[model samples]
Target chain A: MAIPTGPMDLVYRVLDDQLVDVEGQRCGRADDIEFDGGLGERPLLHAILSGSGTWHRRLPRPLRSVGARVFGTGLVGADVIQVPWDEVDDIGSVIRLKARARDLGLGQGDRRRAETVARLPDS
Target chain B: MKKVLQLALGIIAAIGGFVDIGELVFNAQAGAFFRYRLLWAVVVGVIGIVVFAEMTGRVAAVSGRPVFDTVRMRMGLTVGLVTLIASLVINLITLAAEVGGVAVVLNLLFDLNQSTLILLAVMGLVVIVYFVPFDGIERIFGYMGCALLVYVVAAVHLRPEWHQVAQGVVPSWHPSALYAYFVVGVIGAALVPYEVYFYSSGAIEDSWGVKDLNLNRANAALGFSLGGILSIALIMVSAEVFAPAQIDPGFLGTTALGAQRAFGETGLLLALLGMLFAVGGAAVECAFSGAYTLAQFAGWEWGKYRRPREAPRFTLAWMIFFALAFVVVETGVDPVLLTEYAVIFSVVALPLTYLPVLLMASDRTFMGDHVNGVLGNVIGWAFFVVILVVSLAAIPLMIITQGGSG
Candidate 1:
């Protein structure tokens, strides 16, 4: 696929799309997009930010902090995952990353819970 | 021949898995009170579910995203958050009701205490979730739910006037609040949001791809139609037995008596067994749907295809939902009443639940050439209007009728 040269091309194609790791496992969605330039200069896609923290940022200003707290992202101090644009291998129905979610530290909760599950007694 | 057998089993499982605690008593009560007057609502609901389920399956098969995933992406964060909160609340209520229904069924069967049965029901569900593979879960509950076919046989044995039954299928409206309430409840229960959440997610869990599009169509069309038939049969049986007696079949036990009245002891046992599995299956569906919605929206690893350690958060979400539902059930509320509330509240979430699926299914970007056809669009939008009106009116009607008491 041709690389998207303009912001319009990437707007719907990348923004809000579900993120899939190298193994095709769901990591999350592009809850917010980071642009490289401050303003006026040709803005370039920097990274795809995901997780409840990013989701909370999208809320209205009054609700943002409260939403984060209620969703437990703020309470737990969960950081938003940022995947650099270069790591995105393909942009299709889902945003496919070239790296594993674990390698990117995108699935920290899953990794943490996996350890707890590992210690549970077998039925 | 093997392919044909597989198709038949799929259809049977759909039929068996279709009715849950809400449908079981609500359809029965519809028949007992209004005879076949509410049959048209079931038809409307079945068709609505067929259209939506087919589209969701196609989207999942082709686009590889489940319903809630599309829901969150298409609606954006603010609207998506509202939908997510609504869906989770509805899911919890429905899950609690189904768990409660299971306890009631077990209590009736074993003559055990209801509170004790509720605890056992939660434990049994937890154990099943821990051990059963996704496919095994479907087959076990799906097949056992087939015992509900006793209602169909019982309906046939009653041998009602065929012409009258046919006439009932034609759309008719009643000004009575009670009638309108039942109509909304039946349709709402049929198109309950969790079914699509579970169905579309199941498509992904089963690893459906473009090659499975035909299978998806067959499953949605045939599976939901079969379920619709069972629902109608439940109404018919109740109409034949309870309508004449002027008895409202409020409890699960009362509904089973329709079968017993027709075929004696054997039919009653089959009906109760069918209720157990069907409601039990619904509890599992609700639990999984709750987890799937949360995990999918939050972008966590999810699916029964993964081991507990692999999808620990997903597993934890469902386990927590089951425990919460058990607590709700232990409050000594009537499970039947809870089912009614769940169905009504579910109607409120219908538009939010379905609008995203409809939009995604119609989008060429997502579905490619498989985008909804003209017929699908007409039916889809038409049902959207009906669902919107019902959503607005559901709560008011519930209050006015006191949950159809009048």
Candidate 2:
């Protein structure tokens, strides 16, 4: 997958978009985006952070810590599910990644739950 | 001819699936109190839902995103969190109410114990959800839900003054708080947020794409408009039957009594069957909507199309909702009253749920050639303002009217 190179609005376009792995399987969402630069310099997109805990980055300063303390570790106990910027293949309706969900260490909870659900009759 | 048959089936199913527990009771209650005066509010609601559902369905078809995805993306973490929590709470209560309603209708038909029927209803629903295909669920519920058309038939049989019924189409003001409360209830019940969640997610469940846009439009327009007509028929029947006798059709059974008076046992059976499926359909939709919103917001795999094993967490999510609703309904609260509260409170979540859809639908960058045209934008924003005002007014109106008792 060739990467599309250009400046893009990370806040609006990237964050909160659904994350799909190479097999077109949904893993998670871009809960928070990491940037490489700081201060007055141009910030380059570094990584996409997902999981319930990582999403509070968009909240106000006071509420952020409270939310982090409450649900800092996501449901599957992952502090954060991070996918590096280079793994991204494209960004359209969903953020397409060039790797499998397991390889990216994402969607762990659903996979675990899937095992239990598969034990049921219809599932 | 085949395409037209498909379109006809979709529209008919939509019409059948439109009325739920909230509209049934609320419309009947409104008619009993205000006669045909509240018909215009139902029209307002129909137009509002038509605009929003069409937009959200188009968004799903063209962009492959459902309502919750739009909610989290547009509103961000804080507001999205708020909307999710609020919607989940309301959906749970509504689910409980619908489950309770199904049980109540069953008890009426079979003369069985309510608690046992509640358990049976839940078990049956679990079985249906587990085994039936998504479209099968829609058609079974939607087609059987057409039994609610008996209200329309009963309304005509009662021979209400056509002029008075016509006058109800024009909004009239009453200087009573209870009247204001019923108007809000009528409109709020019509635009329940779960409908859109179920709708957009249903679009994705059916694998709709850009070519399905015409079907989406037909479903939203004709389906909901006809559903609005059913609601109006409920009001007219209530006005003609219960109002003159000073009877409040408060219970789910009492609402059916209106039909029974028109056509005896057959009408009663049809009304009860309609309520069972309509309310039963709502219970299923609420469970799925709860799961869909949570999964989409949290970025988990979700949908019935993926099968229970494939979408495990999504399956677990809806099953949890079902379990929770069972516990709630088992508490012996009045199902009709519970639905009334659900309808009134759901209004508060409308603005948060709808604003993102309107924003996403109109964005040329995201929607590409499918962005909302001038007419869609105008109507969308117009209804947005109406929703905002009603959201602010809902709680106060509930308090002042004592939940529409007086």
Candidate 3:
């Protein structure tokens, strides 16, 4: 269960895999990956990006802006969920995290939607 | 005793749940037009579904990831988004047809206006989703839909030539384009993508894990095969009753009359009641399947297990789907026609929906020791080729046959 090394390893093992929390709940998928360090240096894995904003960037150029606009996010500055690599416990079929999904703020949209529903007058 | 009862009930529910509006109408039409000719197609479709459904269910149970989730992972965002869009369009058409079918049955049972009944059907579905628990939804619709067993009884009672029925199971050549159209339509209706969406998501909702793998296999194999039996019975009933009279059963009422021909007023009542629940269950399946694909792909909170307030986006998706279907049905379009169109178009999306599951199910990295065995691989790849052929031919045949009207 050694952590996968090298860029090729990341492509097959980390990028686009589903994120699972400690309790085995699905958080989201790794739509995009963030890296750090300059050229000639070892590029360290930084964060796993999720959400429609990040996903839209992965679409074709013609579709990227349209997807962002339709999904209610800006193409360049949309809300890309950045989960630090430190939180990742394992990476296989799914990126297993050491924390809960809600604790990691992954359920922010769900919580926000729930708050909106709460404001509506009950029938 | 209790375990036996459970197994029997599951089989019965599968039988009832299997024959939705698409199967009811298309299979009946197939038999009416081609007599016993298209039975081979139904057999092929049933086995194909069994293989794929078991694969999807196994993938869901073992990995705790549903079909759409795997679809996005394996196919990547660009292709996944295209699949999502295609699936959504097909689901909308199907949802409209199913709700419309429910209204058609209700109108037959009662003397109500079709438009009013369509609205009522939408309301009924919304209430069921909002108030009923998931298990309650399954048992209510699943068991009640069993009234369709009357068709099986009617098929047997009509006493068609047994040898002809057996021969239909063996593939026969028909050079007509209309025959090919019905073949594709039957397969498309049999293996609609939404069924996989609903089944895999339902596995997650039911909390199935590795321990439930056997249950998953039994459910897919027994449930779908029995459902196929109900489909074959429908064809036989139509062959016995409609073919001789030269009646083209283009309407929902005409399909039910096959049952009435064999059993009279009591048979008519049972057929209508069965159609009501069967189509209603399909409406729920289509609506939920749409919501599931969108929510899972977008990584939004989902599941009928949570309150509407808890899974607001998921709840909103299905609600919007039902509302849109309501508008479409209210346009006074014929539900039977809508079903035929939906079935044909869905075949085009079949490859996009299923290709991902086949890829992941065979990958040992994902499926681990539970990866598809030799038989699974052979059957899986063989059906993949078959589905690809059907997907390519579906639209052309539709145009050539004018939706099989010849």
Question: Residue B10, candidate 1: how far off, in angstroms?
Answer: 6.5
Better of 2 and 3 by TM-score: 2
**Which runs of model 1 end up more than 4 angstroms from their true locations?**
A1-11, A72-77, A121-123, B1-18
| lDDT per residue (tens digit) for residues B301-369 in model 2 | 988989687889999999999999999999998887888898888999999999999999999878999
Tens-place lDDT digits, model 3, residues B195-277:
88888888887777899898888888887887888899999999999999888888878889999999999999999998898
Of the two candidates 1 and 3, the one with more favorable lDDT, higher being better, is 1
Candidate 2 Cα deviation (angstroms), residue B400: 0.4
* Candidate structures ordered by lDDT, highest first: 2, 1, 3
DockQ of each: 0.65, 0.80, 0.49
- The TM-score of predicted model 3 comes to 0.94
Backbone clashes in each candidate structure, one number apiece? Answer: 0, 0, 0
lDDT of 2: 0.86
B343: Cα error in model 3, Å? 1.0
Each candidate's interface RMSD (Å, one decimal) is: 1.9, 1.1, 3.0
Which window of 10 residues has the lowest lDDT sum in candidate 3 chain B? B4-13
Top of the candidates by TM-score? 2
